[model samples]
Target: MLTRDEALTLVKRHVSEENNLKHMIAVGAVMKELAARLGEDPVKWEVVGILHDIDFERCTGLTDHTLIARELLKGVVDDEVVGAIMAHNWENTGVALDTRMKKALVASDAVSGLIVAAALVMPSKKLAEVKPESLIKKYKSKEFARGASRERMVISAEFGVPLEEFLTAALEGMKKVADELGL
Candidate 1:
């Protein structure tokens, strides 16, 4: 498996936009936390999360998103990791959400955006100020964080984690890398 440091280097090489890089890091943090909670390999999950959007900036369109990732990460990571990465963009890639990691990636990817948006709206604009309850409230309001898909986030519950618990985990995970996210 590709190490987290190697994955970060790869992501930095591909994704130049600061916000896009932070988003990837945020999802990685959430994936690490989710993996630890679920008794999975934290490093592997984090690497998968970090590389999930490896081709985001270069992809020509939504349909081309994870498809390019499949090519970029061919031998660097395992097939399972590649599959989870592809599955994160399942709507366009048509990959099956067959594993817990895949499901968690979907939830982590979406909730990271929601959590970041919530912190940005705070008076201090910090992750420390953003609460899980606030995230849940924002999640309920479709007007808030329109890009953060509620449908995708609901996948956490499908994997046995309650919505609030998943939000809490995501909030905690992002908080760990608050400086990196500039939240």
Candidate 2:
């Protein structure tokens, strides 16, 4: 049950590049939002999300990222959380993520990237300055944020919510803490 702050400190020590750190913060913001909306344990889930990519800095290849992250967090977090992180890039790790946390992690991880991309396009380059309409527009265009996996962002709907609605909820969650994200 580590707070996002504690996780950030740990991640900063473990991984120092600015973009990677911001990615963690973005994931944390979205994860906390998703947790609050779902009435789940926000701190725990967000901590899991914030640290999901903890091993990426040391990873030499995309295929090894998930396994590296798992190995790094093995003794430091709950088994469920570790499994969720390992399961995030199942295509790379061959891990099946069936838990709610895992599913949400997949969604938050992907959508947060899209949201941040959208924010950067805004005049203010801030999350609070971005709108659902703008995101929806960008989401519709096949070319927007080409790296963002739409398939992953759609995973939240599998848990019974529509993708657009999921995006709205996730965006609002991040916006609530936009100041921390510098979004």
Cα lDDT, all candidates: 0.91, 0.82
Worst 10 residues of 2 by lDDT: 66-75
Candidate 2 residues 11-99, lDDT tens each? 88778888787777778777777778778888998898779889888888778886877777777788888888888888888889787
Residue 77 lDDT in model 1?
A: 90
**Among these predicted structures, which one has the highest lDDT?**
1
Q: List the pairs of residues colliding in candidate 2.
A: 126-183, 127-183
- For each of the candidates, the C-alpha root-mean-square deviation to the true structure, in angstroms, is 1.0, 1.4
Backbone collision tally, model 2:
2
Q: After superposition, how far is residue 126 of candidate 2 from its true place, in Å?
A: 1.8
Candidate 2, residue 47: Cα displacement in angstroms equals 0.3
